[model samples]
Structures are given as structure tokens and as C-alpha cells.
Target: MTETPNLKIPHGGYVVVGDGRRALVLRNEGHALHLALRVQHVFEAPPNPPTREQGTDRPPRVRQGEHRSAIEQTDWHTIAEERFADEVAAALDRIADAIPALIVVAPPRTLASLRQALSERLKRVVIAEIDKDLTKLSIEEIGRRLTDG
Candidate 1:
């Protein structure tokens, strides 16, 4: 009797999406080809505040006790952006460590930004950009697209 080849693909990497509140970690290699609602992580975005002039007429000051908390609650948008990028970058880094090739299909803008932020080593990997929101799609549909491609 012939044995069936264990075409099991290893964990390719994690897929980080959403506004950091919702993300997916696709471990198994064929996961992207087999996941329906690809959400595995949900985290609150970090807090960031805008920078003020270094030497202002009146230097900014805050009570010691309130300083920490106050500073933490400033620019939410910047905080979210940084945190999201950091999380995604970390996931992609792990993926790069595992394989010689990786195909990243995200919105064109996101793909461009991520491509620029990747390390030199990661840049060596095969990165493809596709404008599709995979979070809403099913594994079967994704598989069909892959096979068709």
C-alpha cells in the first residue's frame, strides 16, 4: 500500500490586520489557503501624543502624578498607527525567518508602506501585493483564487 504524502505545509507566518483591534495569526503554511474568518488577535491600540516645541515661551509642565497618565492619553491616531505597524512588522519578521519566499497581499497603500519598512533580509523574500480584504473571505474562495492564479 502506498502512503499519502503529508502535504502539510508548516506555519508560514501570522497575518496582522484590522486597526490592531482585530488581527489574525496564520500559523500553518496552508492556513491562508484554509481559513474562513482569519482573526486570531484583538488588541487595544497604544496611546501616543503629538510633539510640542522643545523651547517654548512657557515650557509645558504637569503635576508629577498626572504626568504619566496625561502623557499616555494624547494622540490616539499616532499611537494606533505605530502600534499596528509594529505588530504587523513583527509578524512578518517571523515569517521571513521561516521561509525563503513570502507573498504579502494587502491593500496597495498598506503593501507599499510595509514593503518600505521591511528589513533588508525580508526584502529578499517574494512579496506580492493584492488589493483584497481577506478577513471577510472564506478558505474555499481563497483556495479557488490561489489555484486560479
Candidate 2:
């Protein structure tokens, strides 16, 4: 496992813990040695069923003369995740300037979605990006992970 660099989140910096469904925005009031992370905002998306559960019908088949082709079914679950990431980015953009620095923690796919959704200006302020699903972690645990090796 690659050790994450010890993060000294500055005052007013944000640590966004998220996955495909929800995001917890935490702000650091204290410095590197004594980190105090307070949840500033919480964003949650509507629950989505699995792709198979969502799609009731089978994939449609097209026939051209003697040739037949089957098209891939749409992945509803993935689409929902991408949309949620966009919503999260928009929420952050509203207070983009207020955030002096940002630390994003999400699953790999969600992280990629957030990367695309974030505004260019907001992207510049990002200090670290951890490809892990950290939304389930408690506030104190998240703080320890950010600071401790």
C-alpha cells in the first residue's frame, strides 16, 4: 500500500470525503499538529438500483440483411454516479473561493468523475486527491488518516 503524504490542512482548507452516493465536506480549523475537522456540508444523492434491476428489457437486436448485431445495454448505476459527482462539484463551486485548499477522497471511478466535473478554477486549489472510498469513515478517523502515516 502506498503511504499517503501527511497532510497539514491549513485553516479554512476543506477535506471532501465522498463516494458515488454522498459527500461529506469537512473544514480544518486547527493546524498540522492538532487537526480539527468539522463537517461543513453534507450532500447526498438519491439511491439508485443496480443496472440489471433498473433495465427491465433485454438489449435490442438490429438485423441488416443476413447480419445481426446486439447493442450493449446502458449502465444506469454508472450514469447515476457520474451525475452525482457533477452535483458535488457544483455544490463546491458555489463556495469555491472560500476554500483555500482542497483534499478529495473518493473511489477511483468517482474520483475520475469529480475530476471532469470540477471547474478549472477550483481544480487549481486542490492539494491532494486520495483514490479511496472514505465517506464511510468517521470524522476523527478521517483526520487521523490525513495526518498520521
Candidate 3:
């Protein structure tokens, strides 16, 4: 782990943590903190092929039963990871520069991935890791976990 300097700890507040592809915004409530998780997707627009009849009045034809399931697909995990890494790097740059003393709380895997990608100076920033899976739990449940911890 790279040594980060001037780590700042907050008394209490809300922070949005995620890898861009997935994110959880944790906010402190009066009793407990609420966690709102979000998932983002980077979609590539398909190119429209040039046709000789560009000015034709014919509309695009619809192919029934030709749809493919985008769900239940892991073939693009690597691609998503790469894109997510890029997004994380950008976000970290902003965070490290703008909020040098911000306290970060995240899951173990997320912390590990962020640690590996963050700079030595940024690594010095303090973070708290919670093992709970925000995606699988409700906001109220996440708040309970945070308060319970």
C-alpha cells in the first residue's frame, strides 16, 4: 500500500462510494446513516451503415424474435472493469484534490481495488471498510449496519 500523508478524518457526514459502474451514497441520519446504491452502464452506440438509399422513404424494418438478452451476461466483465477503473481514477483524482481530508467508507473489495489504483499520497487517506453488501440490502438495513458498527 502506498503511504498517504495528511489523512483527514471527518466527525460525520455523507459520502458517495463506488467504482462508477456501481455506487453507494452513504449519508448520516439522526440515528443511522442511509445508503443509496446506484448502478451505471456505459453503452456504445451502434454505427449506422451507409446505404445508397439515404433519402428513401422506407423506414427501418423491425426484426421480431431477434432480440438478445443483455442481462445474465458476464462476457463484458473485463471491459466493464476497465471502464470502471478509468472512472474511479478520475473520481479519485477529484476527491484527492478537492477533499484531501475526506473520510471514506467502503467494502473490503472496493477498498482493495481503490488502494491498488490510488497514488501513494492518496493512499495515505484514511478509509473505513464495512463488509456489508449494499447492493443486497435495503437503505434502512444499511443505515442499521452503519449505526450498529
lDDT of 1 by residue, 116-145 (tens): 566778767544444444544554454344
Full-model lDDT for every candidate: 0.46, 0.87, 0.44
Model 2 has a clash total of 0
- Model 1 gets an lDDT of 0.46
Residue pairs with backbone atoms closer than 3 Å in model 1 (clashes): 10-29, 11-27
Candidate 2 lDDT tens digits, 1-149:
12267777898899888898999999999886799899999989897877888885788899999999988999998899899999989999999989998888888899889988999988999988888877888999999988875
User: What lDDT is reached at residue 5 by model 3?
Assistant: 38
Give per-residue CA lDDT, model 3, range 1-149, as digits (tens).
Answer: 22223322243433335542465544343321333322222223233234433334443454459763433323244345455545564565555654333333445655555555666655564455443345446555644444455
Candidates' TM-scores?
Answer: 0.48, 0.92, 0.44
Q: TM-score ranking from best to worst? A: 2, 1, 3
Give the lDDT of residue 57 in candidate 1.
38
RMSD of each: 11.7, 2.1, 12.4
In candidate 1 the C-alpha lDDT for residue 33 amounts to 39
Ranking by lDDT: 2, 1, 3
- What is the clash count for each candidate, in the order shown? 2, 0, 1
